[model samples]
Target: MHILILGAAGMVGRKLLARLAQDGQLGGTAVTRLTLHDVVAPEAPPVRVPVSLSASDFSAPGEAERLVAGRPDVIFHLAAIVSGEAEADFDKGYRINLDGTRQLFDAVRAIGEGYRPRLVFTSSIAVFGAPMPEPIGDEYLTAPLTSYGTQKAIGELLLSDYTRRGIFDGVGIRLPTICVRPGKPNKAASGFFSGIIREPLAGQEAVLPVSDSVRHWHASPRAAVGFLLHAATIDGARLGDRRNLTMPGVAVTVAEQIEALRRIAGDAVVARIRREPDPTIERIVAGWPRAFDARRATELGFTAEPDFETIIRAHIEDELGGRIAA
Candidate 1:
């Protein structure tokens, strides 16, 4: 099958690419061609798979058409302006996150007859605003606290409506805070979540922007990739009219994360972290969902990290080669 990945250069996109390249298949079916697109070119996999790379902003006029022209069997829409970046730059955020998504969906709608492709969109937990109950459920209302969340929630609504209209088979997976993400940080308010663990394991000092008691929902990069792969092949008929689902992830406090760190890498590694609260970050984080009752996703076969320790172990294995004594 032909697979197209947008924003293929980003961290999640790159990981998904690597996973696909290594497996050489999707949903147990052999992949024929892989088309990758991003504003920044992703690292070309040194694999024998037939892969093509393109550098183009999907929001650009005609770019979406070009991308959807071939009518790929699966399209992974992973491109977007992140939380802090989106809230910081309103124009850039709406331009890419909202308008860009619309362009892609429009392109899909304009396709010829019998073109029902699986459009797997990567949304975020930011879609839910504050004043929420302890654990958010699949039926939680979306009252985004930031422009970024609003954009994502809007995209989810669009995906649902479009799917209802039979324009395409779309699945919007509202992802949690991806912890222990590999590589450098992005502008997400949740970046510090990954930074604290990743940097400490790399033998570098990292800052914790909030109190240890700050609770949040989280998942591993491996789990996030699993969600994408599952969405790519899962039967949309099972999803019905609800095009979006809250993905399953571990819910823990920052204190638990530190405890998990001390357990896996000793107190010395945990000591690498310095506590310096940034109220700006804390305020933004306060509006996010503390936990999600993702029973729908769980029932649908979506799995998450067993605990904070599992999250860290997955990171150490995938990003640090199972060695953290550096």
Candidate 2:
């Protein structure tokens, strides 16, 4: 099957690409072609599958059409401006996140002749703002607190509506904040969640921008790629009309994350974290969901790290080659 991955250059996108290449299949079907698109050119991985790389803003006119012209069996829409960056730049955020998504969905719809692809969209838990229960469930209303959340929420509605119209088989996964992200940080509001762990593990001092008491949802990059793959193959009829579902995640406080790091790495590594609270980050994080019930997704066979330590360990194993700074 031919597969298309939007935002193929991002960390999660690259991981998904690697997993697909290693498995050589999607839902047991052999992957014959890989069409990767990103704002910047994605480095071609040394894989046997025939690959096509394109660098351009998909939100631009006619670009989305060119992407779906191949009629890939599965399309993974992982591209977005992220939370902090979206909130920082309103026009660019809406242009890329909201407008680009609509354009792509429309492009698929325009391809009639019974052309339907499994469109897996990466959404976020931020869709359900603060003023929520401890473990938010699937039935909760989507009252987003940030511009990024608003964009994703709109995309979710569009995905469902388009699917109902027989445009495409869509599945929206509301992802948690992926922690211990490898490489340098992007402008995501939750980047600090990974920063405090990633930087210190490399023997570098890291800032704690929020209070230790701050709690939030988290998942590992490995688990996230799994979610994308599963969504691509899961039966659409089983999902019924609710095409979007929150994926399972480990919920923990900032203090708990630090404790987990200390337990695994030792006192010196944990000591590298310095607390210098930033009000901007604190205010933004305040309106985010802390935990989730995710019973629907759990019943549907999605899984994640049970605890923060396992997430840390996964990062260490996958990115750090099972080794960290002393």
Candidate 3:
């Protein structure tokens, strides 16, 4: 199978590449080639298959066309600006998230002649807004509060319409905020969720930007990749008209997270998390959905960590090599 990964340079993108390279196959099929693209050229993964890397603004005229010209068997669309960045820059958010997504879908449709490939889009739970139910269900309305959520919600709608038209098989997974994200922080409003655990485990003081009472959904990066793989290989017809599904995750408050850190990593690591609220981040997070039922995703074989402690341990095992600050 031939695979193409957009946003191949980002943290999740890089992890996906490492996983594919390590496994040497995707969905039980041998990978024959890889086409990696991003705004900046993505580093070529050390895979046995032939690999091509491109760096360009895909939203620019004809750029998306060039990407789909090869008719890769599966396309993983992981590209987009983060929540904080998207909210702060309205024009940029629309251009990259909304316009860019539309362009890619149209480009694939233009490839007519029975050239329909599986498209796995990485959406976010931010697609749902505040004043929401405790465990948001598959039937819940997607009334997003932030520009990033709005863009992802629109993407979900487009994916459904295009799939209904037999243009391509698409599955949109609405991911919760990924905890214990490895690497320096990006501009996402949810950055603190990972920062509080990641920095402290690495022996650095980290800031807690929100209240302890604030609760939210979370999954480890490993689980996120598993969702992508399942989406790529699953029987799309089972999804019916609802091509988008909210992924499962552990739901907990800030206090629960800190307690989890204290449980596994000791009190000192937890102590490193200093409480210093940021009004801007708090406002943005307040609009996001807290927990999700995710019944359909679980029934369809998608899974995540059962609790926040598992999330922290997974990060330590995967990124920290079973080592932590003493």
Candidate 4:
């Protein structure tokens, strides 16, 4: 099987690439060729499979057409402007998030003669806005409060419509806030979700923007990669008309996350989390869905970490070299 990964330079995309490289296959078929594309050149990883790396803006005129020329069997679209960045810059967000996705989808459809490939899109839980139920269900409507969410919701719709038209087999997974994300914090409004746990575990002081009682859905980076793999290989026929799925995740509050950190890394690590509220971040986070039913994704065989503690432990083992600061 030939695979193409867009946004291969990002965190989730990088992890997905690593998993694919390590396994050397997808859906039980060996990946013979892999193409990695991003706005900036993605560093090529040494892999047994033949790999091609390119840097281009897919939203730009004619770029998407060039990307789909290779006719990959499986296409993973994981590119998008992050929440805070999207909210701050309107034109850049719409151009990259909305236009970029449409350009890619249209390019695929333009490729005639039964060239339908399995397309996996990484969406965000931010697609659902405020006034939401305690545990948002699979049936909840997409009422995005942020530009980033709006773009993802639009992409989900396009995926469904295109799939229904038999242009391609598409699956969109609405991922939860990935907790304990490795590396330094980025510009995402949700970065604090991971920062609170990741930084403190490194013996570095971290800021908590939201209150301790604020609840949200979370998954580990490991679980995020698993979701992508499952989406790529799952039987799309079972999805029916609704091609978008809210992935399974653990629901917990800030206090619960800190407790998990304390449990795994001791009180010293937990003490590093300083509560310094940022109204801007708090307002943005308040509009996000606190939890999710995700029964559809669960029944479809997608699973996540059961609790916040497991998420922290996974971070320690994977990124911290199986050790935390003493």
Model 2 ranges with Cα > 4 A deviation: none
TM-score of 3: 0.99
**Candidate 3 residue lDDT tens string, 218-246:** 99999998999999999987898899999
TM-score between model 1 and native: 0.97
* Highest-lDDT candidate: 2
Ranked by TM-score from best down, the candidates are 2, 3, 4, 1
What local lDDT does model 3 show for residue 65? 96
Name the regions of candidate 3 deviating beyond 4 angstroms: none
* TM-score of each model, in listed order: 0.97, 0.99, 0.99, 0.98
Error of 3 at 220 (Å): 0.4
lDDT of 1 by residue, 1-326 (tens): 89999989998899999999889899999888888999987778867767788997889999999988888899999999999999889999999999999999999999857998999999998999989987898888989999999999999999999989889899999999999888988899899999889999999999999989889999998999999999998988898898899999999999989999999999999999999999889889988888989999999989998899999999998888999965
lDDT of 4 by residue, 1-326 (tens): 99999999999999999999899889899989999999999977778778889998889999889989999999999988999999999999999999999999999999986799999999999999999988898878999999999999999999999999999999999999988789889899999989988888788999998899999999998999999999999998788899999999999998898888888888988889899999999999989999999999999999999888889889999998998976
The total number of steric clashes, by the backbone 3 Å criterion, in model 2 comes to 0
State the displacement of the C-alpha of residue 234, model 4, in Å, after optimal TM-score superposition.
0.8
